[model samples]
Target: MAQGEPEAEILLNTIESQTLAVIDRLNRAILMLVTGQPTVSGYSAMVGTLRPSFDQIAQYAPRWGDLIPDAPHIRAELAYLLSQRGPLDRLQTPHLWAALGLDQESVRQIYQSRYGDLPSSERTRPTAAAAPKTEPPSLPWIDASLFQSLQNELQPIYLPSGKALFRQGDPGDSLYLISNGRVKVVVGEGETAKTVAEFGQNALVGEMSLLSGGNRSASVYAIRDSELFRLPKASFERLVEHHPRLMLEVAKVISTRLENATSGKPRADQALSLAVIPAGDGADLGAFCDQLVESLRTHFDCAHLSRAHLDSALGEGIVDAPLGTLRESRLISWLAVQSELYPCLVYSADPTLTEWTKRCIRQADRVLVVGEGRGTPDLNPIERALFEGDSFHPEIRKELVLLHQGGQAPQHTQRWLAHRQVADYHHLDPHNRAHFDRYARFLVGRPLGLVLSGGSVRGFAHIGVLRALREAGIPVDIIGGTSAGSLIGAQAAMGWDDVRMEQENKALFKNVRRLIDLTLPVTSFAAGKGFSSLLKQIFGDHLIEDLWIKYFCVSADLTAAQLRIHRTGLIRRYVRASSAIPAALPPVLDDGHLLVDGGLMNNLPVLPMVEIIKSGTVIAVDVSNPFYTADGAYNYGDPENGDSLPFGKVLRGRVLSRTLVTPSLVGILLRCLEIGTINMESVQIPKVDLYIRPPVDDIGSGDVSSMDKLIQLGYETAHQQLKGWKGRPPA
Candidate 1:
């Protein structure tokens, strides 16, 4: 007996009661049908009612086992009933009894006991159809084994329809994982209560308050009869302690919620007002606003309201207007009401300190502080004062938007972002339509995400592709990758431009042989210590969340048998984990899980990006090798053949000979991995808006000697692929 055993018993009893009630309803419906009442609708309704409960029991039956001995049988019967299309008129009375797992004699005896004698109509009924089999839906995030391990600690709770799970302002002690039915999240109460979101089976709710150590922000109620496993704070903390990546996933959910709250999904009548103010002198605010408005018009009914336009439209002369004046309040009210007319409104603030600028700032729901990327990253005095002032509305979202003239990497961005309390930051070439489009997507709460695919040393090509994207003046709001892409994406997120990455790649692989430290034959050929050291040298102790851009990396968790997305932990450790190639390099054990290359599961991890961003243009750069065939020759003019070779080629061959020997067991495993990865990419690539497959198939995964060539190929491939984006030829 445990501390919560009584509660668990009570929950089980309640479930049994519900199950019996449903069975009683089903039996009565069947009896009615046999009596010539032909209660098809009643039978169908009972089957529908049994579905959620069946799903709930099915999910937890393995864990509960003997506690609910009849769960499996009930579930099977429910499956059959739910699968049936037509009425009970088709099913024979005896067959129906058997299909429902009720013995024919028992059903007749029960019918005789309840009503009168069994009706003769049962004899003429049609034969019962066989139950259709169904496979369970895949839930990659939920670890069944993990839950089984915590079975004793887990408390099962039944939430009936319209019942509150927890109300706003209640103490948050646990989070619930919905096993069945749907729940709606609401804020306020009575007439003011508004349903903000609804979550169904397998959705995690009540985690935010548990993580933040605060009272519940909203009330959650069961929209239907639901079964949930409540994991208390203590158990959750222990789970997180053993599986740190779970924290990362939770953080991502929180980040998504915050993003949604700040910039909700764009609607036809949703008025998203944005104020574009200069960060410093000579920001070219007009050009920036014009380009932004143009880009926004592609997706939204956008209107650019400058000072003159506002004055003309509202007839509110902004001549030396004070902050708290009645005219200012009236103007603000009028602007706020414009949301019903337009989907988006862009307010272009005057560069200098003026009444119009102040009004613009006051009226906006969001503010973009535009600055010249090439100039000193400093805020104008008036803007600085307002930002730091108590009078500034705390709820108004602010973001720094740095403008560049040409397709150059952002300059002095770190200095600008160092202490600035903004929701986000972006680098845009004012003249580039692509940049504006990307920003426009950001404004509408849809952001562009870039997913870099893993291909060992071939991932250096990602640098070149990144270079091309930068040169094309396309902004990446979020980035994710697996294995080698993790390494490259981390550096990119840390603000390493392509040139720096290329230089670093060359330097790191200067002595390619040093990367391998052969270990015991049990785990891996290499211990991966050297590789880990290299990653450590590069990223140090930087956190993934602390990167210049929002970044995440994926790793295959061998312990949990699922892919883990690392978004908040130490960058070096997760990168090491993500790049831990099976057999070639030993898996990295972090907080009890053996994590290997994420390429094993998801070579091109576009799903994480899509999941986080919700709706946006997702660009996936796949540097994965094509599927290998056994018939393909590995020998490139064997030395025994006496083929003439250039001195440079001979030197390169000798250097790589030690690392890239004839395809052995490791080579076979890598090939198999690649085959699986390619199949996965085939499915994932189509989900993205753009897929850039660089011509690096000729290059071997272990080939780092031709870094420059690989990078150049990547750059050329990306440029050619994206040339149509700018409606111009590639430079």
Candidate 2:
């Protein structure tokens, strides 16, 4: 050991002790001042009263040079106080404000407002640049005693002076904290070797690589016979689970080293790579690639590359890249460079999975597998590699994404892919491309879409159900709606997050009477000003054409007798038309045409959504049920023998008009919406069809019992359906 080692150790130990004492005093003093919540009138008086504690902090502050490595402003503030004379009041100097991390112009304004004198500042020096920001949930530095106790939990090892701890380029499997003696960090071979840094007691080594999941950047050797607490990767991860603050401290240490290594400017690459693959037969690879490329290009505004590959047998027709039997390593290297440049690189898999295709899958950070509805693909060699052989990389499943051709996945497929993500497929439409924009932000393996069906007040129950799904982290990427569903769907599509939607739902239901015209019978005209007012309150008076989600609002043109799916327009227009109950409220006039409720034609707009989405799964939350029969089928209201039919079914066509005359005008008008349609039977796409049957005979009542029942059903259904998927440990 060096002659000065004991003195150096004693000095460090004293500094650590004093530093902890200062921190304790500072925290108490700050809390004491903040508790009273002093106003500006007594602010200066409070500062004067806390002068003694402040002096103590200033007295011990110099010893914290190493303890507070990142806070230059704090150090500068302390230095100015150490040189001060009288009480700290009426001294509005620019340097003093700068030392407290305030800008010169802001300080100048404060000085002009208070002290009334702008003092000549000839001796002021520039303040140091603020510390680089760290990702949040920051923690205070641990005291030496607490740090030592943490080390006691790990196994200790001793090494001779000449022993090497680790070599550059080796896998970083552990980190070492010096208990005694010192270690030297070195880089390069013997001829070019240079010392990078040195560490002594309590200093950590090899933490950077361990935290980053990278190789060691330098070699470490004990300069003297040393005792070290060896924290293996497993032990470190276990500690992280309990003490997440340890990650921040480790980041601080690494940031210091990195700042020095790069002369205070380290450029870290923040980009990620993704690969898309097909998981079933007859899947459209070209459409999937185009969707992925367009989504990435539009969202990130960066180049999105897709390499269209073909088997050697079909090489004659291949246009993108003709693989002329080159070396596999060289090809991989070229692809790796392309990946570094582009945020997303989609590789179109050949009909036959080859060794080269598997290599591409292996290189990706994430892989999305596209498949049609209800079908699971046979395990190819690449997929088989995920489970078999000595390399049992279970993480391969985490990378796997099952994007359904339609919105729904079969029960068997869902069970088989319990660990993987299931996402919804989306089409490229100019008006609905906002769905891709919102989806690209998450960059998730499993993307989701929401489908809402109309059923007047019953749709409120659907909203509660959607809230539960969102709380469970089941992503909802886009929304498609019909009638009352359009009202709820527009709120979601217009960027109303869970908290906002829940609040609005409660507020709207509380004043349900204001939205219902009591003077009129229960007909289409019964919708009052309160519904329009609530819509305006929820989504302001603006056309949300550039919203983050792609939405479909279905409304039928009575004049044209054509079903219209409006994507881009004033949201109010769609909501008004979709909510236009025939014979009850006036038909909504849009683009000089009269449009009625879309539910009259297609109550469950799932088939329309399924037709457009080229890839991915969909979540169809149906609130509409043309009343269910005893046999669990739709009750298509018949008017035979003076039976009063549901209002919507009556408007289907002239074929039913001959027998659809009302038996009791007022009674039928009030109970018209009670009859259910055959919309569910018409649905051909496989999806999550949630049929919400309110416990009451009347579906449109906004009573508490009905709303509560719907909310409970939604909560129970969400928790049950997402049982196998939610809150599992990461793969």
Write model 2 residue lDDT over 1-731, tens digit each, in one string.
Answer: 43323433443333334433333322322212222111123222221122233333333434333332123333333323333431222232333333333344544454444444343434343344222111111124434433333433455566656578999998888876554445778898689988766555445677665677678889987755555666677766776677676666556656765664554221121233454565544266566566656766643334333344433422333223334321222243234334323435556554445544454454444455555434564654544554343332233323333344333312233333443333332322322344444445445322355677766666766667677776776556667888768887888766677567667787667856677664455445565466667777766654534334557788878888888787756678678787777776678887788887787766657666654442334566656533323422324444565655666656763465554333344224323432333434444334433333333345443354376666666566656666664322111
Over 4 Å off, model 1: 1-271, 274-333, 340-342, 346-440, 630-663, 672-676, 725-731
Q: Write the per-residue lDDT of candidate 1 for residues 252-328, one digit (tens) a residue.
A: 65566456545433112123667888886548777778888888887767878887776786555743445554344
lDDT for model 1, on a 0 to 1 scale?
0.66
How many angstroms is residue 115 displaced in model 1 relative to the true structure, after the best TM-score fit?
86
- RMSD to the native, candidate 2? 25.1
Candidate with best lDDT? 1
Q: Give the Å error, residue 693, model 1.
A: 2.1
Superposed Cα deviation of residue 184, candidate 1 (Å): 10
